[model samples]
Target: MARKPGLLMAQLLNRFIWFDAALQKSLDIRGHGGVRRLESMCMVYVHAGIRRPSELARLLGVTRQSVNTALRELEAKGLVYLEPDPEDARCKLVHFAPEGAVMREEALDIVMALEAALEENLGRKAVDDLARLVSADWGEAPVIGKKGVGKAKERKKKSA
Candidate 1:
């Protein structure tokens, strides 16, 4: 098949990068210094109640080591602290540092402003529909073999 312009995955990734850059730029204007995308995402996940680095790795689809590294960076920035997990001695739980509260709250407010700006540009309904579609569970990937992708192509050929 010929390549198509504006594929769904590309569009989604482009929008993601756009928002990520926008957030970073807004943070910079507030004199918060530069924050990497992964680091910022880690903060967001931590605020959402994902305490363990292992769970954060799972949610981010990254390795546990990556999550640990990001957490360490956050610790260095005084944005978060990691403590020994009470339930599991081998694990550590993430928490926002006392000094980090102001920055965290400011980042959240920036996100809300970004969303409001999106709604202004795209309309509230469009933004709501985008959120709903992106959040909806689409299930697992196809097996893609003798009975999967090949069969799909065969059906497509017949329809054509």
Candidate 2:
């Protein structure tokens, strides 16, 4: 059965939540303790070089305060630390601690295992094609104006 495009994102989110649950279970067994979705997301963004809290909030569609709170919890877990941004001392940047890096590597291994399991059920080509399609640049998201007109928003630079 063909799926509706509008529901695709929701389906993707559901899949991600399933992955998150599996990840948390594995981490817990490995003594990483309970890691919230937001904290794990923060780690992924920071690992990808998005360090500023404001930027993380924007990407996550949450408030800066929320991002800060999650960061604080992560710090308490000894997974990450907030350091002064050299470019702007007034702002703090997120960086993974030594232990955090190790943890991330372990999580990545888990992800690989999950992907392998998916392949076992869905075939290797299907999994590879899904990854390629999602990773491809699909251009900008649409901006809907009043009267139901829609237009693509220009791509913005990832500057901090």
Candidate 3:
């Protein structure tokens, strides 16, 4: 609770690294090789029955456009079907096709393999806790990062 700035930053960086590794490796297994990483993950989840584009965007910490783009690609690939919402035609309810189920099962296995890798280093309890922490707070809060803050800016200041 009373974390030092350095400690908090370290935890944030660690979460970034672990999550990136988990999601990216899973996407690569799909071999669409042209796929956007996060979007592929979104498609897999949708195939698993998570539907709403807004919810997918919330889950992935991305914009709705990003999720929609991914869905469009997945649909074009014959993996998903998006029916215009009956009550809200502006929204689409994404559902997977039979072919989509095949890919979903494959992606699920890839994710499991990545989970095993994390367990090999961090044990299962720690891994589960990390997942729980992620699910509970997936970008529901805002970041107060300073504008124009970067290593480039710091290097320029040092040179000056």
User: In model 2, what are the clashing residue pairs, if there are any?
Assistant: none
Model 3, span 1-160: residue lDDT tens: 5867668768887776676566666556666345566656776577567888888988788899988888888778877788988878788898887776666676667767878988999999999997897579444344333654365566667999
Model 2 misplacement above 4 A: 145-160
Stretches of candidate 1 exceeding 4 Å from the true structure: 1-6, 141-143, 149-160
Ranking by TM-score: 2, 1, 3
Q: Candidate 3: misplaced stretches above 4 Å?
A: 1-32, 44-49, 58-63, 137-160
RMSD in order of candidates: 6.2, 4.9, 9.0
Per-residue error at 155 for model 2, in Å?
Answer: 19
* Superior by lDDT: candidate 2 or candidate 3: 2
The TM-score obtained by model 1 is: 0.83
**On residues 1-160, what C-alpha lDDT tens digit does candidate 1 reach at each position?**
6768769789788998888898888888998866788898898898889999998999889999998888889899999999999999999899999988888888899889999999999999999999999889976544465676557666777999
1-160: candidate 2 lDDT, tens digit per residue: 7998799989999988988888899988997767899998888788789999999999899999999999999999889999999999899998888867778888989988999999998999999999999889977666664534342222222331
Sliding window of 10 residues with minimal summed lDDT for model 2: 151-160
